[model samples]
Target: MGRNEFTVAFAGNPNVGKSTVFNNLTGLNQHTGNWSGKTVSNAFGCMSYKNITYTLVDLPGTYSLLSGSKEEAVARDYLCFQSPDMVVAVVDATCIERNLNLVLQILEITSRVIVCVNLLDEAQKKSISVDLKELSRRLGVPVVGSSARSGRGMSELKEMIYNMTVNERKTYVDKIIYSPEIEEEAEKIFEKIRQKCKSDRIARFLSLRLLENDEEFNKSLEKSIGISVEAGVHKKEYKDMIAEEIIKTAERIFLSAVSFKNSEYNKRDRKIDRILTSKSTGIPIMLLLFGVIFWITIVGANYPSQWLSSLFESVNQFVRDTLTNIGTDNMLVSVICDGILKTTFWVISVMLPPMAIFFPLFTILEDFGYLPRIAFNLDKYFKRSGTHGKQALTMCMGFGCNACGVTGCRIIDSPKERLIAIITNALVPCNGRFPSLITLISIFFSASLVFPFNSILSALLLLSVIVLSVFATLGLSKLLSSTVLKSERSSFTLELPPYRAPQIGRVIVHSVKDRIIFVLWRAVAVAVPAGLIIWLLANIYIGDSSLLNYFTSSIDGFARIFGLDGVILAAFILGFPANEIVMPIMIMAYTSNSSLMEYDSLTQLHALFTTNGWTVVTAICVLIFFLFHFPCSTTCITIYKETKSIKWTMLAFILPTILGLTACFLISNISRLIFMLAG
Candidate 1:
């Protein structure tokens, strides 16, 4: 309520550069994606124009106010109830016709609306032209042409926003007159809503929505208006009729205000899509691309990781010497330099380089509009497996972080399929587990090769493990569909956005700040406490053995059944808080060191493993369990938060554990049987 502050809401269809425009206006670094569901919640940023303060709200990207998913519901609810001072409806200049559908719906709810036609540069490149004045005249609303990525038209947009919000002005929108029968029904509903609400704008919009037979919005209407309105057969017919009328109106407006030169602006994108999404080539290409990314991460990160380890070692030694020179207690010195510093640096060294390489490459793909095609290519398998196609997108998100993947399931309109996506998300190893998997593959299988070839082999092997995990996800989804979360397979539409060259500078900034640093911080948060607990276990004695020895010895017999020793199993249990610490914990137990330690190289790590009785069988079991074990604590908590059911969360935990243990036990027993026969 400050004199100069005004709140402006930005609503738009997905991938229309809505967030980009918001960022340009506010000077904030919000990461923009070339896909849907990136803005699952509203983001607010304050921007100044002359003497006026504008607080911009970036709502979730939704096709319409008739909400279908959780994201759309958020957008619709805020705009409907919160009633911002003015609304900016950002549209894609390249596809203004399609984007206009959302604009028309937004205009119906409020009179203070400005249509921001973003991505004008792309439209111009395509030889498509939008007559902004004609469009504004047609919609009876002020329109601003903008290419948000290039910072074009932002000044005009801000100036218009200032004029609209700071100064009182007249505004109007061309009415979307529906069919006679639908209008009559809406009129009756409006009469009821009009009596309780102060504004006729909401009453009119609510009437149309009530006539649309949207039961959820109707429930909200009942509470707001103090009257329940149930839909009948005629109301259902009106729903269909109203949607048809809106489409007709949008087409009429688009034709009047927009023109195309060649009418084939998307030919290049189509040609590329053919190769990338064609059933025969798509899967193979996807595998190859991801394999190459893994290879680069592996080869690129090795030296940096070793250098960081050595550097940290030097720092630790210096710190220890300084403490001793100052006459600090030996135990304190061990705790500071050996226990905490040791584990923390190991995590950072091992995690940072690969993440720094991987996150940016992944961001490049996402920016180039390639990730959705991966979902498009895999949609058929998901449908055949009796799950929603949108699950494929959530599965891709799991590759980054299972917790994020779980949160992303909201995009799936069907609750049954969303839960299926959540429960199986962990099978796909996240950023946290990538370090462990890549390391294990390098040591046990690929390390036999020399130099660069070893990294290539590791990439190939990592690809195979990922392929297996995907299959596990599909199989588990099918099982759950048939039994626990049984439901008819739901259909979903995936929008493949236009390909745009990623802004390299933005990619670097976003990848480093959002993905790499965020994940590394989480790792450090868990590693520090874990290092302390680990040191205590190794140092405290129980009778003739340390607590660590007793802990591992108790699990040795059971672990043997899985071709792993007690030390490995204990490490996994202790690593529950974060997967990044598993290797460090195992190393501490193996050396029987009071503090965590890092091997200088894979060769040294392999030598230590051999000393502790590791074999090919043990490595195989470790890899399997590592891929399929219960998710880390963060992901587990996310699952519970999303599902809000203890039963579902427990199943998510137990299902993966059972599958991993079963696979390990079978491999262990079969190998033992073959060895006995050979003997």
Candidate 2:
């Protein structure tokens, strides 16, 4: 029987809404599960078109097919080995040339290529005209325009796939030949490889790759074949020579084919890139963007958060009154009402809104081609730290959550650099810590303002914190590179894609579904148990006070030395499951003191803290401590899972804790000393 089911793979650069297209095509039937032999994820789904089922696989998004990184290797291997019947190379239409390189490279690998010009709506808005027929003719493939967000041209894309799979007509598009000297060497290597390998496609591809001296690809082949390439005919030496030839050849070809002239299509992108990556302008722009996003997150989240908190508080009061009327035990009612449901409600109200706003907007910037420029902007610093410049991208992901950031470190090529990137990912402030920062900002900094400026101030303070965090990361990375994980720096080759407008509909869906809900669920899951524990500690009496009171009072003096209370300290300890629960836990501790189900307003919140000796020092210390706290549970688990050693995992946890504690201690003590001197 002929191949009845054809496999179609979606390949693209990161943040071009590749996943959006995947979702649109497969819908709810898609399943993402583990691969057979690796810990890396695999996604598979089916779509039937014209009475034939096409199994669509979403390969990991990667910038290039150079096999320098694990993700690239994964993508490269599937295209070469799995030999999918049809390859849907999704190119972000707004950034055609850089995107075109991937399209061109894949064309070299397999002729059954479908060039998907995705984000057409965005491209059109940017006034970028991609002549699909012209591009198709030049590249020798069928090019289809698609707006994955709106489900445009999907039917056509699938039809194209079906036709390609059925016809089995391979289009040998093009291979850009190099200078005579380099091409001669490449040809010699190609002839030798052709004589050894059965598959001409594999032979040609491997010859080019081998000549280019891609160590990762060579290692991967060695592992698969049970023979060291180096042991046979000094393959390493031979491959190195070939690699130089290939690089020179490719360099010539790349220079000949692409131009960086300031065309209208790329004018906005080049202008933005110049400023954002400029030595002088880049840092300030990063700060401004950071400040703006936080400001919006803080102000926009406030009304919704307050309403959600009040609504939850009202339910808590109703439950208590109903239980009293119904003659249920007061303790049992308190446990059920304040402990489980109340905590869940607070988590939802406070954490959800900011994430909902932040993720989509963050994703929008990423989709608009701003993110790669960030990496390019910071590449020099990261390279100096003996890591890939794109580690900056991983650090940005850390702002959402450390676990995701650590996972993103896979983008870096060097093992030493990847580890360094992973170890320091948690230093950045995540969405989980945003509420506490907002609370401090609103209470201390923005209490005097009205309307727009109030939110603006709050946003500015948060942005300052982020900027400070970047400096902290840079310093820590520098120290780490010099001391422990020393290795040669792996420089980055960043392709700045053209800027385009983001799709609101798709951004909203991803932010709501993937980020906001996912994170909220994780928080609620952890918060319920934590709430019950906090309730038990606060309610169960021990020697004239509740367990919580006894503990807090015991540590009250020690906490005072650090300008914090035992309850706040305890909350930090308990909140390791997820940072989102820290503020709610602190609130629970505060409200339980009066056993009140409701508070009046922001003034009441301030009054509660002031009554408990909450000085400015206390708030500052809390802010700093939260900013530099240990990795969350998910991050810890990821560290353990990734390193597979309790030692490295513990190191990942401990080093940060020690640093955080020392920094907070030094800052607090220094402030106190300054005050004493002034007095």
Candidate 3:
């Protein structure tokens, strides 16, 4: 421990609120980086406690320090090589025994540790009794129970860290001993590491990793020590057999040291799982949950959508009339009023309302811990598809943006599974597509002449499409794994976290900050340029017809087969930068006024579509095309980066295009034939 200043590292198992605790301790002062070229994100921050500054590094969350993956290797290397002044090993109090495995591993490396048993509030809520002092005595570490989210026990935790760092207090950790054969191998590796690295405090840890044949840690050590310890060990030839024995021995030691007892809550988990994960009930419940969320979003979004639409339309009318009353050229007036301003108006009006309602609701469910249960329920399907269970997490992220989904795939350990996840991520609908889907459903599928159920129908249909994509992804992944991208399914463990009461304030702010504002800004930015371009094409006459008219006529035949026109197709293409701009572009083209924004009702929208010769076939085709179509701009960039191959990126683009066009063509043909027969 250092006297006045100390380096404190926070380590924990995944999803134990370690990041939240770190953020609370350091506020917003944090720096992020990749640890030794691995994709896992790491962060370091500084916090002052009792007149002493502690530099705290937050390690990647993992189940154990076994170095089974790149992230585990990063955490293991930092703790071993850096040798922080004190290590705060945070464990979830509710799941103490499982989390203790990691703590035990950390203790083997350094005696300078304080076990922070967090989530005490959650534990108490579940009526689980934890004797903190007894646990502290048993583990031989200073135990502090905390709920970091509510700021409880944080001051005490800080005091404990400061005291340990400055030698004002001391703690011991229980020693774990393996069987004679395992102990002998560990001792042999420890001897080698001590001689090579000249540090006994960390040698045992290094020895165990070596025995496991951890590729990540071994590579890390090679960079640190300028030699491959594995190569040297194998150069002896007999060491390979010795290394195999070490892994077998370590696994026995690990299982012996950890005891998983079933509590009353565990029974409840079983009872809940019987229904939640049941073949008959799980799918229906999932469908119902999705439908309900969409219904809420649709109902809540309508008034705001109407308000925003009216507000934008009023501005558009005023600008157009005032400019026309002046001596300004109609072209100039149209460009200013319709092209630039109208596009901005429609983007804000159409996009903002739905996102404003939907994001918070989604966030609330996430915060309440429902999504994980959803994932847990679907894990079997994914496993059968030859991917890890946690690929479901990336799929959830896809709802926000597919690029983000692709980025989140780093959580999956297997290279082949992660690639498969990335390839199929675009199948999930992102927030940008929400407005277009909502508008289309409302306009085309009204059950009542007076009231619209479009948003409701749209949400359900979108959910169905998402479910269908899941199956499609699983089928493709299985095919790929068996044939071209053949690889074994990487073993994955998922934490089905206990459900909790969600914080409304946090949910709202997070939703607004992370989703609504970010997407709205993107929509407006893309909308302005798209608006101007649409206006130019609509107004610029080629001989007798406008440029937009010419384009529409040129693609008319092909569009008919696909149940779309050149104008709608072009709008969708332009909207690739941001899907929120599609409806605005469509309206602009249809009205021939760069700024017509008064489509406040689905009836008005339907009238507009009807006047333009839209059919049921067109609506069905549009829906199908939107479902299977091209990746957005951000997704394209992500594809390029992830594959680092232009070929895969082209495949991502072309595969969707072919599927979307074929699907739309088939749907249009069947729909037109049915209509003709019925008539």
- List model 1 lDDT by residue over 86-170, tens digit each: 8999999888888888988888889799899998888888899999999999888899999888789999998889888877556
What's the TM-score of every candidate structure?
0.94, 0.83, 0.82
User: Quick one: best lDDT, which candidate?
Assistant: 1
Predicted candidate 1, C-alpha RMSD: 2.3
Model 2, residue pairs in steric clash:
211-242, 211-243, 212-243, 213-243
- Each candidate's lDDT (Cα)? 0.85, 0.72, 0.72
Query: Which model is ahead, 2 or 3, in terms of TM-score?
Result: 2
Ranking by TM-score: 1, 2, 3
lDDT of 3 by residue, 518-574 (tens): 766775678778878888988899798888878777877777778787777877776
Query: How accurate locally is residue 215 in candidate 1, as Cα lDDT from 0 to 100?
Result: 74
Instruction: Write model 2 residue lDDT over 1-679, tens digit each, in one string.
Output: 4567889988877656566677788884221111111113346778787777889888777766784777888888888767787888887766665566566667667778898888888777666666777677667778889987788988898778887887675564766554455556556666765655536666666666665666677787666443234422223455445434445543543444334333566566667678887888997898788778877877778887788778778877888899989999978888888887777777777678778888777877766667777777777777666667777778777877788778777767777787877888888878788766777768877788998988888888878777777777777777778888888766556655556566667566766677666666766688788878888987888667887787777777776667678888878887888887787677777777785645435777777777767777777788878888788999989877766778767777877777667776777788889999999
TM-score of 1: 0.94
Of 1 and 3, the candidate ahead on TM-score is: 1
- Best first by lDDT, ranked: 1, 3, 2
